[model samples]
Target: MGLDDIKRRIAAAEERAGRAPGSVTLIAVSKVQPEGRVTAVLDAGHRVFGENYVQEAQGKWPDWRNRWPGVELHMIGPLQSNKAKAAVDLFDAIHTLDRMTLARKLAQQADQQGRSPHLFIQVNTGDEPQKAGILADELPVFLSSCHDLGLSPSGLMCIPPEGHDPLPHFRLLRRLAHDHGLPHLSMGMSADFESAIAEGATHVRVGSAIFGDRA
Candidate 1:
């Protein structure tokens, strides 16, 4: 299966939920995936691909831009402060803006380049220590600080831990998006995306379901 099959499957998922098909953006998580596969998806008209590593993106994005200039790229992994500048130069959006320091770095770097990619504030939906997201309770304060920098966050993103019922977790992200006036909710992935769609995930990152176990 590939991007075409993923599109049809997502359409079916939406139809099952009584939602109109094509309402959600399918962010193909291409982390550690071959650049050839990314091109194949782009060739199939699936333009948005998500990359988790800056190094992988560094190689793939330039070639992608040379090939499919209209394609969109999103950084869907934890972003470290040292690599913020590289991310600013490459990705069209970063989905893991969880700390004030990193947000500031991104803003400054984006300003240096005279461009601001779409941004997402990742929240720890399950409050997992190992996750790279602001805690639900800490969001308001964090947002206020980010607001001082005049960065209008585009949305909230999260990844619920495995084995948890994802509906409630997805709902929490939706609520966080709405309460914060965010228009996008980046939730779900290959495994629980259907449940996520039912709970109002505006963006679902699909990988194995599309590329089939790149590992």
Candidate 2:
């Protein structure tokens, strides 16, 4: 499929969900994707990109940023403590703020750097142990700490377990956002995004659905 197709699907899904459409941001996940594909999307008017690997994002950000000054970069992958400083520099939004150490460092570094982007708490709403996120039961404590650290915990992001219905996880996230009074919900991806949109996803990451299968 193409970028237009992806946008159409998101719009239709929002309509089906009885929610207003076109409000949600579609982040073209360029993890493992070549620069040519990303460039094509950029030419096609996509400005926000999500990357999973720090090295990959590092390789791309400088050039992409120079080419499109207003382009936004979001880190949608698991981040290590060692890479926290670099991640803060590269990402316009850090989507996997799970631990306190990383959270504290991010706030301090952003304060030091004097210019860091938005931050989002990653929730293992799927309750997957292998993921890099706080458990659902542990989110409030995490968010409170993040607030204390001065990081704007604008929203929540999650990757649901494979083969499981993502709605439950997505719905849980939306509820958590409402309970916390956060307006953003960065759920959904290539496969189950329609359901995510139906469940009120404020941001959806589309990779292969836009660029075709990866090599």
Cα-based lDDT at residue 2, candidate 1: 73
Off-target runs (Cα >4 Å) in candidate 1 are none
- Tens digits of per-residue lDDT for model 1 on 50-89? 9889988897688778877787889998888999999988
Give the lDDT of residue 11 in candidate 1: 88
**TM-score, candidate number 1:** 0.94
RMSD of each: 1.4, 1.2
Per-residue lDDT over 55-125 for candidate 2, one digit per residue giving the tens place of the 0 to 100 score: 98898789988987789999988888888889888889988888999998898889988877787788988
